[model samples]
Target: MSNSDDSRARDRLAVMAGIDVDNPELRRRLDAISARTAERLHQPVSLVSMVLDTAQFFPGSHGLDGWLAELHGTPGEWSFCATAVRTGRAYVVPDATIDPDQATNPLVTVDGVRSYAGVPVIVDGHVMGAHCVLGFDQHTFTPADLAELQDGAAEIGELLQSYRRGDTPA
Candidate 1:
């Protein structure tokens, strides 16, 4: 997309609006979304990550090691969610080693991450984060897989709105 669009998207997340990452209720809802996403996509890792200017917070996640406890989030430079959020579309990287944009992404550590597919989680008409799945093999997702993820993202959007409205994410 255009730089203007990127800027507009960047301006919209409203992180200052305050997302309570530690909210147990929010975590429960996000966990369900992440688990379902992983199962539906047949990937080893699934994450509902908020792509802030500073980092990608894995509020809802699967497949993360203990490193996340030590570090609240992954650096933006190493965040695939950052690129996906900027694109405003589903970012499909079947093979990180071959994808120019993702080849250097830290998620592609040696035998760790080889595939990724993510849908932008647009909140209040702006990009806030991504609902994504990752794997250790070069697995190309089908169109149905994308549809499933997009549908899941819609649920996350609803949850975000509910959180903003001070309602239960359910």
Candidate 2:
């Protein structure tokens, strides 16, 4: 399929996932996971971000401040998580300032996000979104760090699946 076709399909799946961006209970559960991920990874910020057609929604977030915390999301162009969703793989930026693909990203140039690591959150065989951590200073993530991030992503995927099945996740 073409890129646009693939994007459309993914967008459809995101909609069908039925993630209520404003559901306080869901947000609280996801926030707990985000907080744990940040503590485990020793990162300054972590987010459970759902990439939609126009934007990425932060249903779960930790260590965010100011406008980002208030907005709970950002436009798709600013999303590092969108790369994870599109590729269905982990996306890492060891140093956004030096990476050609990330050098101009606002989260880098504007928000001072120097490093990022993200893993896809999948549900029902579809790439739903991402679980990601961000750092203010350049940090080269080890394989173990990625593994821990992947575990967090898996937990998020399972939670999303539970929601899809109309079951409250414990």
Candidate 3:
């Protein structure tokens, strides 16, 4: 479902994710986290994305240059993170080109993101966003991969809660 049609719980979590909060240190920390996750997962991209009604904002990201990862955000329909939120679980697509569910996704067709692994970042029992890794080459995700992503998502969730609590990064 679209963020506009999302549950109040989801909306609350999004608010808790501090989408409007301007914390440069937090952004830097998140970006570093994304970089680490990408390296750990051997993926080309990793992102801490907050889903919005019309778009998804990336406070943290790796493997994306100014070519497409705009400050304003990409369209929500183009976001795989939205799928994680919709499922409220880790979503994996081994090969977007072959997966019926993801084959036609714009991110796959337009940007050539072939494989994806995303874990929902929940706050107050609602999915606010996702910690995601993307690959340009197709690679099946194993249970272990899912578990690692879950851990990363958990860390993201904790950091988000701290942000909401006004805990500044040192």
Candidate 4:
């Protein structure tokens, strides 16, 4: 499905979850939560991203520089996070070197990102984007890790509701 279609599904899910996407405080909370999740997961990079009709926006990220660059890079096809949202499921690559999908993806190779784990950031029930973690070494993700990632995604949804309630854009 297209990005907008996916986002619309997420928005509907958010509404069902009683999350208000107009709150401004949600942005701060999302940022803080992203940091905490990253630290807890012991991952080098963690992000709470929103998939727009075109680009992905990282209102919250840890262990990364340049919001517009790292979090919000090219469109969905080039973004693993976007793929998660589009698929409405978790996507993990223990080693990009061995992932066929990464063959044409420059970021995975150029940045030496050997592993990546992403859970759909579901606002309500539809996935708006994802909460993702990246590692530089070959890493293995477990059921516990996936659980934690899903929890983080839920938190992100709540934060988005808060942001919407506050009429804030992120």
Candidate 5:
């Protein structure tokens, strides 16, 4: 499918799955997950973000401050997590400042996001969003780190699926 078509389908499934971006309870749970992931990975920031058509929404986040934290999201063009969703795999940038694809990204230039790693959060065979970690300094992620990140993403997927089934409180 085309990128736009895939985005639309993912958005539809997110809605059908009852993923509420603004639900405080859900955000709390997601933030807990993000915090754990950040601590485990020794990263400064972590987020469970849903990549929508117009933006990437951070339903769960840790170690954020200022406007980005307040907004809980960024424009689609500013998302590193979107690459993971689109690829249905992990996307890693060891140093955004040196990566041609990421050099000019606002998150890199303005937000000082020098390193990033994200794994796709899949639910029912569809790519939903991502579980990602960020670092202000350049850092390379190992295979083990990717595996751990993927485990976190899987947990997020299960959490969302449970909500969709009404097996958990919203």
Candidate 6:
């Protein structure tokens, strides 16, 4: 995509408005979305992570040992999550080992991630973070895969909106 379009796409996420991550119901909804995403993608590791100044925090995830705690303090270099936020587009990494853009990411080298696909979770034009799925084996993705991931991320945003309006996520 063009840099201009990428910038506009990223500007579309307004996660800083209307909701706070500290809300319990919001966390619950994010977790549910993460779980469902993992299952739907048939991926062993899936995560809903939000980027902070120095780290990315996983409110929800599937697979990986001690995932919640372990993934909580991931630095920027370890963050494909942050990349999604920066680019404002879904990242479909068919092979992490060969992708120069992410070849040196700590998660790619140390975390055993071969294939990574994720969509940024944006709310009210602010980026919350990303909903990501990691495949242990190298793989290819289709348009359907991107659509599904995008839909799941949108659901996360919608859930946050619902919480703000005192309604349940649909």
Error of 3 at 151 (Å): 1.1
User: Which regions in candidate 6 have their CA more than 4 angstroms from the true location?
Assistant: 1-18, 71-73, 164-170
lDDT tens per residue, model 2, 51-152: 887798888999999889999899999999999988899999999999999999988888999999999988767777899999999999999999998999
Relative to the true structure, candidate 1 reaches a TM of 0.86
Regions of candidate 2 where Cα sits further than 4 Å from its true position: 1-17, 165-170
Alpha-carbon runs more than 4 Å astray in model 4: 1-24, 66-72, 165-170
Better of 2 and 3 by TM-score: 2
- Tens-digit lDDT string for candidate 3 (76-113): 88888898887787888889999887889887898788
For candidate 5, the per-residue lDDT at 151 reads 91
Scored by lDDT, model 3 comes in at 0.80
Ranking by TM-score: 2, 5, 1, 3, 6, 4
The 10-residue segment with the lowest total lDDT in model 2:
14-23
Name model 1 segments beyond 4 Å from true: 1-10, 69-72, 165-170
* Evaluation by TM-score, superior candidate among 4 and 5: 5
Cα lDDT listed for each candidate: 0.80, 0.86, 0.80, 0.73, 0.86, 0.75
| TM-score, candidate number 6 | 0.79
Position 127, candidate 5: lDDT: 78
What range of 10 consecutive residues in model 4 has the weakest lDDT sum?
Answer: 15-24
- lDDT (tens digit, per residue) of candidate 5 on 13-130: 6664575545677778889999999999999999988887778888889998888899989999889998998788899999999999899998889889999999998877777789
Reference-based lDDT, residue 87, model 5: 80
**Candidate 5 clash pair list:** none
Q: List the residue pairs that clash in candidate 2.
A: none
